[model samples]
Target chain A: MSFTMTKHGNVVVVDVDGQLIVGNRQELKQKVLDELEKGERKFLIDFARTGYIDSSGLGVLVSLSKKIREQAGELRLADLNDDLKTLFELTKLDTLFQIADNRDRGLESF
Target chain B: MAPVRERWPSAAGSTGDPAGPDAVRLALQLEVPTDVRLIGRIVQLVSRQARELEFPAAICSLNVPVALSEALSNAMLRGNKEDPAKRVRIRVMVDPAGLVMEITDEGRGFDLETCTQDPTTPANVVREDGRGLFLMRRLTDRVERYTEAHGLARNVVRLTIKRPPPADGS
Candidate 1:
């Protein structure tokens, strides 16, 4: 998977493209952690183009969310399609993360 | 030794299609390393075949792939411990009845009954691990775990998903 990071005001939007499976989940996790380490918080992950995600990918997201929350930083998700929304709901992660319908909404939440 | 085809009578009975006209059976075997990329590739290949057989996108693209990914990861990562010297064997069968995928790893077997945890609990919700087996059970129609006594004991995870009828009513 590939990620493009762009600044939308104070919130950093990371657009993840392709499937987020075990093979490439660490890349996303590392990037998020690096941003966190650099003191850049208020993150929004854009999943509009992502087609699929396994439990491994969810684990990465969970870790990222926890790390950011622990540091008093905010993390939000945007543009999750039906399949992804269902996945999060099934795993009960929807209750743990702040999800928005679009990028603007995700940015506005922070 | 001849290839053994141990039909899952339980799965057949569940689908209520012991032998139907639309039941076409095909089996594929692959020996892959403990690489996640290779596992994804294998799942993609089988998913394409599932699509060609008129499986719905929800099943072929989403449900099957998710279940297969979790099962394969467990076999390759946890079971084989990412040992390149060890190989993971994947056996896939698609028939009118449904789809059956068996992933065998060259690791000591574990009890399937003990592989579950409550992911919805408050304490486990934020954890980054321990959700693979849960996802596998949720996404597939049936999941069976056992050990095969070959030269060395192999951990086998069998997943079965029934094919949905065509949307166009064909």
Candidate 2:
């Protein structure tokens, strides 16, 4: 999977393109962590092009959420399809995350 | 007997009742080292086979791939402890009814009852490690574990998902 980052006001919109599974989850974590280190706090991950995500991908998201929260920043997810939405619901992460219907909403929330 | 590492064509030419005379069944076995990189390739191969066999699009695209990736990761990381010498064995059986996959890892197995906790609970929502087994159980219809004792004891996670009956009338 690849990450395309764009700046909309203060929020950094990260577009994940392709499946985010075990193979490349760490890359995502590291990228977000690096961004956090650079003082980019408000973050939104756009899953419009993401096809699939496994447990590892979920784990990375959780860790990133926790890390971002610990830094007094925020993280949001947007554009999750039905299958992806179901995954978050089943894992109870939906309650933990501020998920938006689309990128604009996600950016606005931050 | 060594596990055959090959893909076998469908025993029955048509997708029908597995027990019926014209039942369709495809089998594949793979033995690979403890490498996380191979997980995607294996998931893709299985997902493609399921789609070609006419499994539901959701199952072929999302459910199977997610469940299989979790199982494979568990086998490689937790079961084998990432030992390069150890191998993970996969056996896949697909029929018109559904799919059954057995992931065998050459390591001491743990009790699934005690090992896995509800990741969705308030207490464990932020925990990163336990969700793999939970997702495996959630996405698939059946998630079972058994230890084979023929030569060496090996832990096998058997995942099964049955095809849902068609919607009412037309």
DockQ: which candidate is best?
Answer: 2
lDDT string, candidate 1, B1-170, tens digits: 99885654333645455666455777788998888878668888888888887777788878888899998899989899988888999888887767888999988767888878979799999889888888888889889988887677899999989776666988
> Model 1 in CAPRI terms: which quality?
medium
Residue B32, candidate 1: alpha-carbon lDDT? 87
Q: Write the per-residue lDDT of candidate 1 for residues A1-110, one digit (tens) a residue.
A: 69889988888899989889999898999998998899898899999999789989999999898899899998899999988988999889999999999998888888
Q: Interface RMSD in Å per candidate, to 1 decimal?
A: 1.0, 1.0
Q: Backbone clashes per model, in order?
A: 1, 0
For residues B61-83, could you state the per-residue lDDT of candidate 2 as single tens digits? Answer: 78999999999999999899999
Candidate 2 residue pairs in clash (backbone atoms < 3 Å):
none
- Candidate 2 has an interface RMSD (Å) of 1.0
